[model samples]
Target chain A: MRQHLKKAGIILFWLLVWQLVSLLVHNSVMLVGPVETIKCLCRLVVTADFWLSIWYTFWRIGLGFLCASLLGILLAFAGAKKLILGEFLSPFFAALKSVPVASFVVLLLIWFGSKNLSFFTSLIVVLPILYGSTREGLANNDKKLLEMAQVFRIPFGAKLHYILLPGLSPFWKSAFSLALGMCWKAGVAAEVIGQPLQSIGNRLYQAKIYLETGDLLAWTVVIILLSFGVEKAFARLLRLLPGEEKKEPDSMKEKGDVA
Target chain B: MTIQVDHVSKFFDGQPVLDNFCMELSDGNSYLLTGPSGSGKTTLLRILLGLTRPDSGRVRLLGDYKYSAVHAGVVFQEDRLCEPFSAVENVAMVSKKLSPRIAREALEKLLPADALDKPVRELSGGMRRRVAIVRALCVPSDVLLFDEPFTGLDRENRKKAIDLILAEKGSVPLLITGHSDEDLGFCHPIDIRTGVPLQMG
Candidate 1:
């Protein structure tokens, strides 16, 4: 809510200036009013095609992000435990992080069909962020606490659930939040270039084809809102995970056997 | 079980922190580890904890190697509690089955009772020191190793912390390292000088 309130204040301040600029310019073609954009959004929302377009893009982009996060977390754990594996993956992660999104989109389009284009693009963008943050968090974990756990013969599952998870949560959550936003932006950009059917990117391509700047702007708003909603939802989900609660004595028990 | 150190030598950057040091604990009992600064008191504790290996010789327990049994519970000079977590959570991180009331009781002896709910970062230096000692005691270990466990506490807090350490179960042995004469009053510490002693804690 704090973030939303801050966002609302910023957008309102910018919108007031945008409205004044549109009125002074006296041309919707040059600079559209916020109200006009809202009107365009409302009109698009009434259509089933627009809703389908939104869902199609959302699924593809969301899947890519999910895949990236899972693999990134697994790889991070592996890389943290083994120096050789970490060394092997270093240049590979660096390459993915430094490469341009457009370049990857073009290369991936040639490799995969346009239908799954956004999925691949999202993975490429999200992977390095999750991997880097998780590795750093694991490396900087409370070494003394780990030693204490070892001396006490703490159950392996308990060590992961209690010590490792709490330590890694902040890094994972922040990386996931940023990566979610990046994946959505890059995924949409890829879709716009590829023009997948029943997708927001395809709608954007259509708008540009017909010179409908308002349609382009409206679809852009839908993409942003959907991405923001997902990020907020995921953050809530992260909080709900069992490992997140700091006060473990209240809830933690011998949950089966330690691996 | 006895912890025996036999002719162990340790060097950091070739400075010879400890040379041919040795000590033997008779059995499960209390011991005060005392030495001058740079006498390798902390390094000896680290060797006992298996955190640092001796450059030569070995530390063994009951004729077995160190870490072979549930060896030692260590309290370092620094209060290394997790900053974002409550003092109780920091303790619980090491001892999963550690009861809340038990942890509270352990902390209550050395700290203000109200500090149980506060994060370690919000705690005062003395309070964190107490928490660290409580954490080490909370873990069920065969031998307790404390490194400068009474650094910042005033006389009142120090007595309380020492009392808490005494309150722990007797089956586990306690070895403490400190520079204060008052700290040595609780147990007759074998005086260790620079270079190597023929005995160990």
Candidate 2:
């Protein structure tokens, strides 16, 4: 198709520009071309150590993301149900939102060491995002649905399944999209600082130390690919959930029931 | 089941909505609540449905069982259906006794068969209202409430909806709030403003 060819042409043009820039620099340490970066990636992919590092980093960051999501959901429900709990947690959330990631990274590195440094870092980075979105979602639940449930005497289980889940799904999607990217960035930064034994961050650090700009670019590309891939996969899984396919029409909504 | 609203008083922003309201609702009879807007008709219904608390007096359900145990089905003024769910899912989600087949059959009387599987959000307002009506009727409850349930329905569909309600409802009390006196056959009209029952021809 013309569109595909156009996309290919655009990509090739960018690659050509990068190759020219690298030739003009004439210093491999200063700039790595796309070809060298791809070659470095090809060499890295066949190694056992590379796969081990990928797995280690993947699971640590993934576990942090999972933990943050669960906690965020629980806290959201608790805050929505009890006003006092929401008030009590306001300062904590504010502090979490305002505190610098680098400060936490340094402190966490000293306290917990490098083994779980990335885990805690990712959790901290993602928690407030998911929590805030979840709380907003719960707060914005349709009051009409609540009244209907009350009058119909719909059971708690049915209300949760039919109303709450569908209502909160948009918030979940947005939260997950943002949290995924944040988790990967903060997680890799943590690993770079903490220098975990078998991690992509450690590889990136070593590449920088050895002046292997191609390896550094390849590792950076890998992070971007993994982050985007995970986000897409998670969004797909969310779409597969029951009742998630029903999207609100932008314009033709019934006058009174838009809420 | 008998619903007794005894000297119930409710105030919003220091203004009385339901002042010394009293009423008796008996089973096997449908009550048509006719009142002007802001006459506390909805407030009375909310109190009866246990959604609001009265500042004074109490609403008692005098029967063999406790008032809290009795379930009341409601067709809200707005079709308060789960937007993403199909008509069958919306009906069956609240029903403990009626199967999906029975709910589908009940909905088929008021809606086209092809519209049954579509999400309630995609359906027109009339169709959604019918879905709400079917949802209320199909559920296992001791009483039924309809708050302007016929707002967007055509005359023919309104009649069909009424027939569906009558067909599905048993001896349980059905209380409906309507602005017009037309099409209120066999229903005891009660004026919430005067606290007096109006005689109907």
Candidate 3:
């Protein structure tokens, strides 16, 4: 409870600072305080268009992330098994990581239309991260455990359940955390450029053109909340995967044990 | 089946770990392989399991073997139980022939009932060792290989583990490595360095 209060107090301090800065500027066009941004958000929430815009971008980007994750894991498994495939794809994934998100967004807009820009953009952005993390995870799997499995002739399904998933959990968790945030940023940027109809990015673009600082800040706040919410939800989903849960040692409870 | 270690030699970094070691491990017998540290006890076990290949020698499974490959239940020097899994899951995961119920029964013979449900990581060292022993016994294999399986085990638990292994490893060749032959005198004692049976004085 104290920790939560401390966090709220910190946020309130920053809001006070933001309000003072906006009052000094005295131009609502250039700067809007937290109060104005919240008021704008309240007004936007009542409109049907606001919910529709959220749904449009949410499904597209969410689908892109899910598909990329599946593909990345499958490809990483194949890559790990075949050295030649890993060697072959190393440069391709590296290039994908290096290329700027804007360049891909522009090129995607030309090849495809604005309709599926966020989907493709987010997919491309998240694929390499997932692939790299999974590859590293596979590489770091305990060799001794694998050898034990091999000697015992444990089936592939059992090995995957007992060894592979648990080994990959840590890497996947960190990678998902990173890729979730990256996908949202890239997906929204693509939407803004493509000006997709009935999308959050389209609203953000309109807000910019009309110089509605309050609407812009409000939409930005919405994106932040959405990104945070999705990340938390995805993390909770990841916990369902089979692995070890870390717990504090209860010395008193551990006594009188026999083996 | 008899596992013949025919002059098996393994070297690391141009140094001889096992120089022309030879031994015959026949079926329905247990061996206590005694040696000091760095005496290639583990190397010999690895060679039998085909995890490591000898530099110049070969291992042969003589007699009628149902399978082309050697299937072994091994307890490694380290307690290689999946740390996140409970003792029952660890044992059950080794073979489809063994289920969670079967594993729980086997583990109950050596471990406390309360410890069976907890993750192996949370268990004490001796408890983890016992879990490894149970996992090895639960797996279906033609041979049983244990390297330092008694580490961290007290005399009472050690006796329980030994009894469980002997009961479970029926008609299979069992090779266990340890620091001494005390309390393991029932098995034929062999010094790994000499690769021959020790003189029982």
DockQ of each candidate relative to the true complex: 0.33, 0.69, 0.75
The sequence of per-residue lDDT tens digits that candidate 2 reaches over residues B148-189 is 989898888888888878877899999999987567787888
Interface Cα RMSD of candidate 2: 1.3
Candidates arranged by DockQ, highest first:
3, 2, 1
Clashing pairs in 3: none
TM-score against truth, every candidate: 0.87, 0.91, 0.94
CAPRI verdict (incorrect, acceptable, medium, high) for model 1: acceptable
lDDT of 3 by residue, B119-149 (tens): 8889999999999988888788888899999
lDDT of 1 by residue, A1-259 (tens): 9999999999899999987887898766566777888888889889999888888888888889989998988998999889899999977998999999999999999999799999999988999999999999899888987876676677878777667887888887899899988998999999988888999889999988877777778887788888899999998878754345544443444343332
What lDDT tens digits, residue by residue, belong to model 3 across residues A1-259?
9999999999999999999999999999999999999999999999999999999999999999999999989999999999899998878998999999999999999999999999999999999999999999999999988888888888999999999999999999999999999999999999999999999999999999999999999999999999999999988888778874633344534563532
lDDT of 3: 0.90
lDDT values for all models: 0.80, 0.86, 0.90
**Deviation of model 3 at B93, angstroms:** 0.8
**Candidate 2 chain A worst ten-residue window by lDDT:** A246-255
TM-score-best of 1 and 3: 3
Q: For candidate 2, give the docking quality class from DockQ.
A: medium
Interface RMSD of 1: 3.1
True C-alpha contacts between chains kept, each model in order: 0.45, 0.90, 0.93
